[model samples]
Target: MTEAPSPAPVRIRPEIAALPPYRQGKQAGADAFKLSSNENPFDPLPSVIEAMRSATAVNRYPDASASRLRARLAARFGVGIDGVHVAAGSVSILQQLALATAGAGDELMYAWRSFEAYPGLAAVAGATAVPVPLAADGTHDLDTMARRVTDRTRLILVCSPNNPTGPIVRQDDFEAFLARVPADVLVVLDEAYAEFVTDPAAVDGARVLADGHQNVVVLRTFSKAYGLAGLRIGYGVGHPRILDAARATGIPLSVTAQAEEAALASLDAEDELIARVAVITDCRDRLAAGLRAGGWNVPDAQGNFVWLATGEQTLEVAPRFEDAGLVVRPFAGDGVRISVGEEASMPAILEAAASALSLLPEGHPARAM
Candidate 1:
C-alpha cells in the first residue's frame, strides 16, 4: 500500500495539457434539426451504401496507402498517383501535413475564425500558431497575412470559403498572395465545402495547381457534398514530394476499405450528388436572404451555411435557436454558423433568427442596416 501510494503522477506536455480537445458541433434531439456540424443533410446514395456493403472485410486491414482511391483522384485531377493522398478525413491529412512540416520552434499560420481544428493541429505538432484576424467582412486578410510570415513559418492554411464565416478567398486575390509567399513555405488551400460554392470568382485549387504553383496543396472531402460524413474519407492533391511527406506522417491504415468503396460509389453517382448540392445551395440562398431581410448582416455565404454576426449577443441568441428545435454552431465572441440542412428545417431556423434579431441590442451588427 505504501509503495503504491509513492507512485508519482505522469508528466505531459504543458501546452497540450492546457489545450482542449476538438469540440464537435452539438448534437440535437430526435425532434430537432442539427445544423451545427455543417454536415451534408442528404442521406447516402443507395449505390454508395451497396458499395460499402460489398466491402465486407472487417477482419482484414484496409489499403494502408488507399492506393486505388488515390489513383482515381489522380486521374480526375490530372496528377500522378504520387501526387494524391487519402485519409480518414481531410482534417486528418491536414494534421499530417502540419506534423510533416512544422515542429517545436516552428510556426503554423492561418486566419482566425477558420476551421476550429487548425490551432489544435499546430499545437499538437509542437508548433506555434499565428492567427491573422479576418477583415470586418469576415474574409481572410491575405495581405496582412503575408507581412506576418517570418523565417520560422513552415505552413500556412488558407481555408477557402473560410469556415464559420463563409466568404471565399477570391481567385485573383489568392493567386497574388501565393506569389508573395516564399516557395519553401507549404500553403494548404482547404476546400472542404468546395462542392457547394456557387461563386464563379472563388479560388479553384486545380486551376491554381495547373498554373504551376508547386508548393500549394488542395484538400477536399467526401463528407460534405457526397453525404459521406459517417464514412470519413477525404483527399489532397499536391506535388509528389509534398504528398509523400504527408503520407509519411499519416496514421497507417486509417482509411477503411469500406470508406474507399463508398467514395468510389459516390464518384460513380456524381451527377446525383451534384443535384443534391444544388438543392442545398438553394436552401442556403433562401436562408441568407431571409436573414438579411430580417436585419442580419449575412456575408457572401459561398458555402452551405450562413454567418450571423451576433457579436456579444452570440451566447444569448444561440439558446433561443436550440430551444426552437434548430441547433446551430455558436462561436462565443464571434457569431453563429447555421448549416443549410433539411428544407423542412428552414422555417424553424427563420423563426428563431427573427426572434433572436429582435432580442439584439439596437444597432447590433446583426441588426438590419
Candidate 2:
C-alpha cells in the first residue's frame, strides 16, 4: 500500500501569511550608509556605556520584574510604579497589548504607512488590522478615524510626530478626538520621538492619561532619547489595572541588567540627551530645507528625521541612493522616509534625492527629471 503523505503542520494563523513582510533597505555593501531604520547615529553617551559595562553579569538572569528600571521610569514620568511597565522595547510592549486585547474576532486600528510592527502584532494575535488613510497633509484624519472605531475595534493606535510624516497632533484636536472615542476602546499614543517635538500644541498624552483617563496609554523608548537602541529598553504608562493586565501577559525577563543600568544612567543625564535631540531636530530641519531647495515636496519634520513625500514607492528612488553609498528607507507604494542620522550623511542624502528625482516624471518631489 502506498504510504500516506504526512499532513503539513498548520501555521499558527492565516493572517500571518497574508501580512506583507516589513521591507528594510539594503546595507550589505561596505560603502553602504544605512539610514533605513530610525536608529541614533551617535554613539551612546560615554556615561551610559560605562554604566552598562558595570552591570554586565552574564551568569545571572535579568531582573524578571525589572523593578529598579521600572521604578526609575516611574519617578522620571511622575507616575507610580504600578502605572509604569518596562519591557525589552516599546515595540515589545505593543506586542503584549495586541496579544492581551485583540483576538480572532477583534480588530486593531492604526494609520497606514505608520509603524509596520502594528499589523504584524495584530496578525500574531489572530486579529484583523484596519488601516485608515492619512489626510492630504499626511496627518491622521482624526474625524474619519473616530468613525472607523466600531464595536469590534479593541485598540486604536495614534503615532504622533507620526512616522514618515513627522507631524504631531494638536492638543486641543487630540482631546476632542479622545472625547469622541468610546471609553472602552484602548487608545495608545506612541510618542517615541516626543523629545524632539518643538510644537507647543503637541498633545502631552501623559497629562491627559494622568488626569484620570483610563483608556489612554503612552509609549516611550530609551532607544531614541537615551541612545540605547541596541540595549532595547522602552516603557508604557497608563492606568494601574491596565498595566497590571499587560504585565501578566508579557514575556518574563525581557529587560536585561545592562539595559537597566544604562537606562538609569541615561535618566540621570536627561539634560545632555535633550541637547542632543535638539541637534538632531536641527539636522532634520536642515535636511528638509535642502530637499525643498532641490524642488522636493519635503514635509515639515518634527522628529530626528525628514520625510520626502513623493507619494510613490521608495524602491523606485532607493537605487539612486544605493549607488551613492547611502541606504535610505523606501516604502513600497507610499513615499520615501529618510532619517537625519549624522552631520556627514546630509550631502549624500541630497545628492541621492537629486539623482532619484531625475529618474521620475515631471512634478516629482525632487524635480530631478
Relative to the true structure, how large is the alpha-carbon lDDT of every model? 0.92, 0.82
In model 1, which regions exceed 4 Å deviation? 1-8
What TM-scores do the predictions have?
0.97, 0.93
Q: 231-273 in candidate 2: lDDT tens per residue?
A: 8889999988888878888889879999889999998888988
Clashing pairs in 1: 295-368
Who wins the lDDT comparison? Answer: 1
Per-residue C-alpha lDDT of model 1 across residues 278-299, encoded as one tens digit per residue: 9999999999998888778898
**Candidate 1: deviation at residue 183, Å?**
0.5
Question: In candidate 2, which residue pairs clash?
Answer: 296-365, 357-368, 358-368, 358-369
